[model samples]
Target chain A: MNLPRKEWAAALCALPASEVKHLANVLSGELEVRDVALPHAGLGLLNLRDGAFEESYFIGEIPVARAEVIVRSAGGMEERGGALIVDDRAQFARSIAILDAVMAGKLPGSVPAMTLVQRGMEVRQQKQIERKKLLTATRVDFSLLGQEDDEDEE
Target chain B: MSYVAIKGGKAAIDGAASASEYLRSKGSLDEPLTLAMIEEQLRLLTSRVVSEGGLYHPRLAALALKQFQGDTLEAAFALRAYRSTKPRLLESPVQDTANMRCIRRISSAFKEVPGGQYLGATYDYALRLLQLDLANEDPAAFKAVAKSFLRDTPETELPDNFPKVIDSLRAEGLLPPVAPSRAAAFDITRDPLVFPVPRSAALATMARAETGGLLAMAYSNMRGYGDVHPTVAELRVGYLPVMLPHPVTGELMEAGEVLVTECEVVAMYEGTNGDELPTFTLGYGACFGHNEVKAISMAILDRALQKGMQDGPTNPSEDPEFVLLHVDGVDSMGFASHYKMPHYVTFQSDMDRLRTTQQKMQQKESEATT
Candidate 1:
């Protein structure tokens, strides 16, 4: 689903972009939202950490772009019974953590395999970004295609 | 970027169930509760749950204890509340009275007739103090006692499934066809009772009626009002193989067995709808488990209500809906406990109405004085 960057960030935390859109629509009808923003962090684009407990989050000015936008939520009282929009990027990031934990033999069950697939997809996207940059810069969208994603470097 | 929402609504319900389970099992890891244990230890409570829940499985009631955390009343509430969500697995159609597997059968009639009277387990109207020894005794001991009684009277004739007393009346043309015709084929479990129920539904209602309430109501009628003295025409208690129609085979198949207490009472009936002199009419009772009191009370009420109809409202027992509906255990308990829930919304509405009425009354009083 299509989503703005701020929404994409929140979705990365928990919900998918499509679900976030639905929540936004529902909330807009119920209560007015003042503002939304995506803050910077030590990593590339500061994204919400993935966890079942974390849902409700905030995001501010940014327009929609490329990416499979899924809804996610910030972990908070507001997100207690709510949903948010997310994307494959955020899902993959979370899956990596799950996979890392599983490979370390800390996590249990099929959670590792599932997240490994997610991390692999994200790595493939990183490779495509490097090849794209070699070709042309004008065609690259930093947020969507992650033209020079910080995570790709590390 | 705009913040968007996410998550599944059903996850909340799962979380709730998990939380409930955790709360129930906290701390207690030993002496886990069992169905037989509940039936034996908490017999009265189990009986109440079964009576109200409209299901007679003691084990299910015990399982409900785990779900509701050993709160007998709440367990009963849960049992009934969950009943609506369950699909009826099988339908045990009405069996002919002559087909019942009679374990303990008896008749108070003369020495014998078609089937000789059998004293299955009669304290014989003697109210003896309940022996405390039997409370925690091994079940095998009780079985041995019954075995010994049977061995002592090897030649004693035991009555099988005696034909229904009502059938005999029907054959003699004493009772109107309206009597037994209504109950010919009935399934009470599947059907919610409609008001002014046919005799079939009425019988089913009494069959499953709670013992204490039923006995009280029946006794009230007997003491002064309805005057229904019914002789035990027949009584039976035994395990019957519960059969159901197979969807694939399209044939009857035995599911399992359930113990049942069945009793029928014959009372003198004055002719109705222009008939001859007074003849006998039947009051029948049957229920899950070996609850003879419930069965007998049910039989008494069955006869009283039918007989009292001739006398109108003067006979309180004649009101089928009143007796049948109110005497239900679960319905009674749920309704009684429901009052505890906050009704602030409805209460506020009533308070508003009362204020307006008071204002109106004050205005009228001043106007009259002026």
Candidate 2:
């Protein structure tokens, strides 16, 4: 409740797909959501412009999923939240909307929602570190160039 | 000449399909080709598919590659076909390439750029010799070597953004001032291309064009067919962020990042706008992947087309209609292969005309002999 509902929604939306799915499963029993707007999938255009901003162009379209839901808290308070996710996962979009509504209502389960997001962030960071290590190992070493040059000269 | 029309042969067509599928699966049944391997190992191929298909989904591109059995053109075609099925949503905000998280940046015009040139994952200096040991090498050993290489390389910190070379040129008044485009981007997929099409539409067409076709046209220009001798002012391979305006707050939010290859070509163009001073004009090319040759060729073609606009187009590359129409692999492929279809009636008509001409010539020869 202390944190802005928008920030909470952003955090929830930012979580990895697996983490979001896990969180949804964890919180599905605790919250009740009525569909304000049914989840739908559509395409969003990626507009590109020239260097001088001379003209805008549609490069291509990307799949977008959107949903809106109204959450009814145990305390008899209701809040509506809208979600616009940038993929074709209609279920994920629906879950995100529910999470947003729950955050907006400041329900008792909001504490778990925040903690789940934090956990997801930590996991993502750890994965990023591992990936960096792997990529660093593959870096081409230019230092052994002198040795190769000497061999070529002989 | 005799010709007969036959009914449908659905069973034969079905058998042919089964045979092709069987051939694809026969050899690789023991160890199947995984999508991850295709994505990682054949990265350049996958990138080309993504770029030419005008789609950014790696998984879909990988699936396309699998379905097409590593045929790059076919994979690109498949991806494009898949793209046609999807719906258009909203236009993303203009992405600033100057702020791209650059992995590789180089300039051929200048010996050095503001941030030093970093040649990341390039084959420019690599020896072209085939590695014979790869044929019999253990897969686990290969993985181990790759892992060790990644572990040993020292990490160097790079700046978050790199300065554009053209911007510096503009500051020094070396480049010509660009007029703002009258319209927003033209969607090549939806709108029919009118001749003397906007530069944006032409560029969009080239972005998804067959790399080989673009290269041949550009190569001809570089070899003295057209009037564009360009220096690579900047070639950058990096991730460009895709930002979308938030539905709720109406502020730009980072949706994702797409790996793109961008090239800025510096060329001398005689000004047609009554300006006596010849100014350095820029030709720009950017595509969905790290295809350097495609980007460079596209940039040269972009410049070559500009010359045609000022003076009447003298070369094929300079003609927008000629260049754009032939570059699409799908269109070219479909038309080229259409000859495989049954043309029995036309063939018989041609044969009858040839026989009539031969009989008349024989009759004339007999009369002369008599």
Candidate 3:
């Protein structure tokens, strides 16, 4: 699904915890965001469904940290950015808010912000590929011994 | 009967808290119990907390362990409580276990699979005797002995993906064809579980269930209380990638990897044909971390719950309500611990009823004597 610019920014903010933290650190030097709201921790429910794909059930709760910020572009146009982080990293959420604002405002340096997100995704994909390779080595291959037996009765 | 609330125990409660803290820190001031030690040495416990908490962060689980002073249930509770504070951003795409990076994989049904079975880091063959030498052993000596066990040369690497055991049976029509799940995945945390719970909800509940509770129910089934004889089809310990849909392109993107234990057990079932032939049905269990027993028990329970569909429920384990309601550590612990709370009003009422009955019985006895 093609996401709007703000949603895309939120997705970037929602990158894997370590990657998001790193991206935030890198972007903090490039952009300045005014606090629209203070970052805080909250809770969210995780839902589950049965094997039959029938009804939903409540599993448990998950901690979420969120932050909101406003950014002003070089042209003096301001836009709000918000982040809903999955864990309890307040600083990381704040950084996400800044990046979100930067992207939402369509700031001059937003291209670099998008590039950082792409790089983060690439790194994650590379790691996954390597992990899959190691796991694939463990797959059990079975050797068939006899000629195929076909039974037909009408 | 009357009851009054007790007040003004704040000082005593404060003192008790202080005493507990002092006791926890009394042993040593120099060398502290580190989170690293708990995460590494007590890995199974940490894994249990993570699995039960339904969160994958080992560091947070370790901290919870420290805070709870190594009470697994309480640690899990703390983790769950912490999890509730976090927000839900996006649901990860379904993980394919076939693509997992497996560190260990085994099957009891097959003597050999395409890739040889890897018995990695298991205690199955080790003697149960405790090493008394470890009580005051030097760290350097322990490291030396551990290093001695490592192989100088690496063995030939195994293949990446193995064919699922169930797939072979399905190919030959020995197993029933399973329709793909059509319902959207549900979060057990978000909704209360109702009767006839979906397999996903049951598995989710069991995944975080207390190990002993699950084991007891599973043991009952194995001991003939229920009808299931399970053979380990596949038991694997691995890391599966968590993927999310890309916001811009909508392509699935790898988010991260979570360590998990996945198990599939094959159980005997009556064939659909008119003849008295037998076929195989599958029971699956998976959870965070490398807990084989929990996973296996979960698999057993998963199959047992299915017995209700084929045969009328004859056993307690086969009842979804009985099994699911009693398995959660948090719920059980809360109920169990609540007994310690004051029951003044209820107890006073019971005492009054007993006294009245005793007075009536005594008066009748005196009249009979007169």
Candidate 4:
């Protein structure tokens, strides 16, 4: 069985909903989308390793959106697409899954879909870079804490 | 504990529900708090709900707070209800604190640590005076102040991660060696907690414990009820990345991150075996969102519980069952509020017993006097 992919869908999710919707609209015209099952928008259980014991256990639940689609082109080519995100929009997941199928199958409107995916990737990358810069700025250099050898005693 | 079911309160209950909605809107003074406002502006409060609720969805936590009019316990209960309806997807890959993208890191054990102490966003030293100007804060001024700070701060590329303070101590053989355990992971949501639960279960319980409830128990230990006086090894507040396996390919994929606070406390050391070198006992605490007090208190209690479990419990904090069963916000709140429910039969029976005893006492006194 062919697999439904997620990386592209994740990148697409980073873009604004309107942008994803626009691309999805352009490609969806030539596609017949069928839900492998109904999209799921609910909790995803978060587990963590206990620091002391180092054993894993349930910590909390995070909001999640998951969707799977079988897109059949007008010419009868089929491709499977799926996405699971730690967000709470089933509709967005469905739209991105459709886009994922378009990009993967290289179906009609694939170029525009690829462009949108690139934009989303760039957005995610920029956000990460900015976060890293701010976090690094706060790093401490404790060597500056001690008095210099030539300093006068108080 | 029997309950006499009361009928005919549906209409009154409906009226009360509608009245609550009206009061909530009125209490806002017509300036509704948006979910983003609640999530960002009311961060600590929202964080408390997220921690106590044991759910990492900040937006839903904000929504819960909005619906409950900022009642933390009810908001947590609402989160619990919301999560209970959802299916359990899968367990996440183990997250190591060494990889945590830290925003704040501090150590009380030593003045110098591997990662220089970064006191990122803390009010520990702030005087608890109320800011009168905040009563009518100007939004433009607020934005300007934040903008100016951001603009002025220079950015530098530094190491992506920091070393754990505990690692330095561990290398010196001062800290207890962590023996990797092969125990199966426990899900508190699914299974009934039997007595003498695993250390992981206890940790999970404390992770979602009510801050006040955990504090009350931990505070007693701090005031000399327990022998585990601890030094803070490390306390970190940061975002830990979440990774899940791809549904199809079975390869791990990053699934965003969750904000968390983690703490490790070192307690007094005792020899494990004859002629063996004594090492410091360690306790660990972590929870969703930023609650330093909760994390520290949990760390202390964690050490105490370890001592109790190992050498027999000398304090209530050391007792696993006592602490775990009582510290949950939802459980304690529910049990506390259950008194408001109609307990006519139980109270009436108590009254009957009391009246009978009083009548018997009167007869006995009269006979004796005669």
Q: lDDT for every model?
A: 0.49, 0.73, 0.69, 0.80
Docking class of 3: incorrect
Query: Could you tell me which 10 consecutive residues in candidate 1 chain A have the lowest summed lDDT?
Result: A43-52
- Model 3 C-alpha lDDT versus the unseen true structure: 0.69
Q: Which whole-number lDDT from 0 to 100 does residue B64 have in model 4?
A: 98
Measured as a fraction from 0 to 1, the native contacts recovered by model 4 come to: 0.47
lDDT of 4: 0.80
- lDDT by residue (B1-370, candidate 1, tens digit) is 1222334646976998999877767887756677777777676567555554555556777777656776656765676565555433223343333555554566564224344334444466567988888779887886696456444543422333455544554567665444224223334555687776665566656655556778888888778767677777667665554433322223443323345666777776666565455666667666666667777787778777765554554566767877878776556766787786556677778899999999999999999999
TM-score of 3: 0.77
lDDT (10s digit) by residue, model 2, range A64-146: 77777777776688877667756777788777766666665666566776676566446544434443443343344445655
DockQ of candidate model 2: 0.34
Candidate 3 — which residues are off by over 4 angstroms? A1-27, A30-154, B1-4, B141-161, B273-278
Quality of model 1 by C-alpha lDDT: 0.49
Please provide, for model 2 over B210-257, each residue's C-alpha lDDT reduced to its tens digit, 9 standing for 90 to 100. 888889989989999987889898888877766665455555655556
Residue-wise lDDT of candidate 1 within A1-154, one digit each (tens)?
A: 2222222222223333344344335433433222222211110110110011111111000111111112222321121111111112333332322222222222232232334334434553443343222222211122453555556532
* Preferred candidate (DockQ higher): 2 or 4: 4
Please provide, for model 4 over A40-109, each residue's C-alpha lDDT reduced to its tens digit, 9 standing for 90 to 100. Answer: 7877767777665466766777887777788888888888776677777888878877877776777777
- Candidate 1's displacement at residue B93, Å, is 3.9
Q: Which candidate has the highest lDDT of all?
A: 4
Per-model TM-score on C-alpha atoms: 0.53, 0.87, 0.77, 0.91
